[model samples]
Target: MVRAGLMRIARLRVTLAYGAMLLVVTSALATLDPLARERIVEKASTNLHNLAHGHFGTLLGSAFVVDAGAIAVWLPNLLCLLALAELLWGSTRLVVAFMVGHVGATLLVAAGLIAAVKEGWTSTDITRATDVGVSYGAMAVLGAMTAALPRRWQALWIGWWIGVGAAVVATGGDFTDAGHGLALVLGALVATRFGAPEPWTRWRLGMLAVASWFGFAMVVSTTAALVPATSCGLLCALVGGLASRLSALRTRPTPSATDMVPDFERHALS
Candidate 1:
């Protein structure tokens, strides 16, 4: 019983950490100058003029745009949702999934932004915010859960992805569908890889960390080619990567069927 309680508490801590970070960042941005806030909203929304002021007014009211409209302040919200999802799916698997999904998504978004800028479809003043939602993380969580669920339910994950894709289309402006698709693929791959416990080698963790950081850096550097944006991405990647690696290190070996029976009986008796 004590062990179970401790495990629950640990899961709650991860969820709260993500949520707290979002709250802090959003709250701080809300205190920024009104003009700065407006500029950030403008950069975040491609259809700002078409969408009612109230539609994104709340988000804009709590966001800040930094470094000439290169990076906007909504990361906390995204991270909070991701963390909550991670907690729900158990720390080990979800953390790995989040890292892969986030980095992969960011890279795709950066690529789209770069292409848009080159084609003169979007200005340097605009930052794309379409693919930064928590829906992808939620989808990944659902995907991982499907492994435990009946096989017939496997198609549900695909349906969820399609729904998200449609949502992106409906909200289209400078949205990047490529980013969403890439994230789903990466999330699924990570989920499949980490589904079973394997040897925890420092080299494997280090390689993943390096790749994750490199991808994060590319996203930051390409977004604005500015110091602040790059700095933010670097910091996020470092902290997030460390947390993920630690969780992976702590992953227990998969139990055999015999090992599971006693635990099931104990729980059933309890």
Candidate 2:
């Protein structure tokens, strides 16, 4: 019981920290140099435009366009979602899983963006109407939570994401369906692994870590130069999906007690 309380407190702290970081970043972006802010907005706008045109490459490229700028704006929302998950799954393992899943989705989007650019499938006149920060991450969070939810409730959440995506498209807004899709896939994969927590097999985890790092590196390396943004995002999504599947495969016989006991305790204790 004491251990559980400590875990809860820790999760709250982490969530708060994430929130603070987000607030700071938001303020900085709003008040920083005009040129920097303009660049950020431009990149964000370009991202949205690419998303609308099915230029997934550019959307992912947009993530890396502002260095830590995008992440600063994005990670807090993702962390908040994970905080909710922590309430159910406990702080340590669930947080790690959430982080991994979120990072995996980001990388996947980047890969897809790069791949699209390489293929010359994207248009040159990319505009900036589609840059909404962190919506994809939020969607991914909801998707991951839904995937981990009981089978009966899963469909509703899945439908919700689909509906949201459709609405974005219908309204002619800049929505990165590709990023949302990739994030969902990553979340599902992470949820599956977490749902059935297996033994900590070094080889499987190592492989996933390596793949994720490689995808991240690719995004970083290509950010400055002229590379195919859409193509890279696609690649990230592919690699992330494959890695998640591999991790899921290794984590057989899901960990029921870990997920259930915490919730049960909270309810019972309260």
Candidate 3:
């Protein structure tokens, strides 16, 4: 009975199954003719056609394509990071973090691209660019793992990720890097509800602020036709003003006992 119980527990690891499937599919794709593999990846992509057109069905399909060039590197990391996340957070939470990171980053990127197109900063043809890979999901899982670690370790891991992401964004504001940074933020945000300490850490609240700003920008930009520019500008101003007020509330110093008059002394004076 003891042996059977241990075996059952071992079998419950979702990461192994997911990793095996990833490897198998990646291997199969590698064996296919180059053109065939390319066609498959293209069809699975969540580019302008799938995202802007609301064909979200392709989102899951696109995650299966591991990007042939990145398979050796991404596959190992996925297995390790996902396995560790699953070990800490269980299967369901890991899946949620991964999906939130992958889907949220993809949508955010698509929205930004659409906004850029409307603003005429990027060529309209850029929308058709292929966007398929597993890094977003991997990075998301990796990000969530920070909340599962000890506080000291968490700081180091999260800081390293943020620093790298910022460096990447600073150097190259490409779609992939944008998606990566967004994925990390989404991962950290989503995982807070699951494993993070109570009272919410500074990083957790910071993620919320970032998310709120990003969401506001995305909604306004996407609905530029429906919302007047004046109204949108006012909305942005309101959100920024509110955020500043909240920050002030959080940062304002509280009075100490010595800084306040005793109620008894005031009553006696009156």
Candidate 4:
């Protein structure tokens, strides 16, 4: 079981590396003085000011940083979605999905904002909004994942995604919301290239890994609370172990009928 789990983890090379990179950057950011961290984060923002100045590098740089306060949530979120995409589509394809979703949507949003401001539709303060995080890329991967669902569920999932995004845009949500929405759309379009979902059984390991991670995270979070809380980490670990073992068993070559005979009977007769 342990070996199987390790092997499964090893297959997620791109996902783990990206997560580690984020962790390194975030840990370094946390060590800085609060004001210094804020300044760096502001500079990394892909907001209108940065975009207008043609600091296009922020488009790539901003994905590597997150607000100190948001690291916990965004890190896990990035891992699960991005890892699944990597597992399903391989490293190169995952990179393609992330870049398309992140860079494409960001540019689109900036263009919209530029047009909006020029037409006297909004305040200039918006240009300075902080827009650093991996969520746009995350959303793109998430949107593309719709391809993995059953057909009925796929339609429902896509509708819910787009409906929620459009609703947010209509109600005057932050420009980031629009970026997120556009990323999802772009990701879904990318999914068209991938066509049908992979086999259902192929995802068992992914579900097991995701469940174990979330369960462990939940236990850690809940245990740190004001009062005692349920710790399901043990349960999750058990489930993951069982799942890993079962997967190994299923893949083991079947014994021939002659080889299946009781060892004692076969030896005694001989």
Per-residue error for 90 in candidate 4, Å, reads: 1.7
How far residue 236's Cα lies from its native spot in candidate 4, in Å, is 34
Q: What is the RMSD of candidate 3?
A: 11.0
Candidate 2 has what TM-score?
0.49
User: What local lDDT score does residue 223 receive in model 2, on the 0 to 100 scale?
Assistant: 38
Rank order by TM-score, top first?
Answer: 4, 3, 2, 1
Per-model lDDT:
0.47, 0.50, 0.67, 0.72
lDDT of 3 at 62: 79
Go through the candidates in order and give the C-alpha RMSD of each one to the true structure. Answer: 17.4, 16.0, 11.0, 12.8
For model 4, the superposed segments whose C-alpha errors exceed 4 Å read 1-7, 68-70, 195-197, 202-270
**lDDT top scorer:** 4
State the weakest 10-residue window (summed lDDT) of model 1.
61-70
Q: Pick the candidate with the highest TM-score.
A: 4
Ranking by lDDT: 4, 3, 2, 1
TM-score list, all predictions: 0.46, 0.49, 0.68, 0.71
Error of 4 at 115 (Å): 0.5
lDDT of residue 68 for candidate 1: 25
Predicted candidate 2 versus true structure: per-residue lDDT over 1-270, tens digit per residue? 999988767856755665565666567676778788776656554343445566555444343333344554445434545466555555564545545544555556555555666688655343333443444444444455654454544554444344443333344422254555566556656666556433334553343334333223322233332134334445544554565567667877777755667886868876
| Cand. 4 Cα-lDDT | 0.72
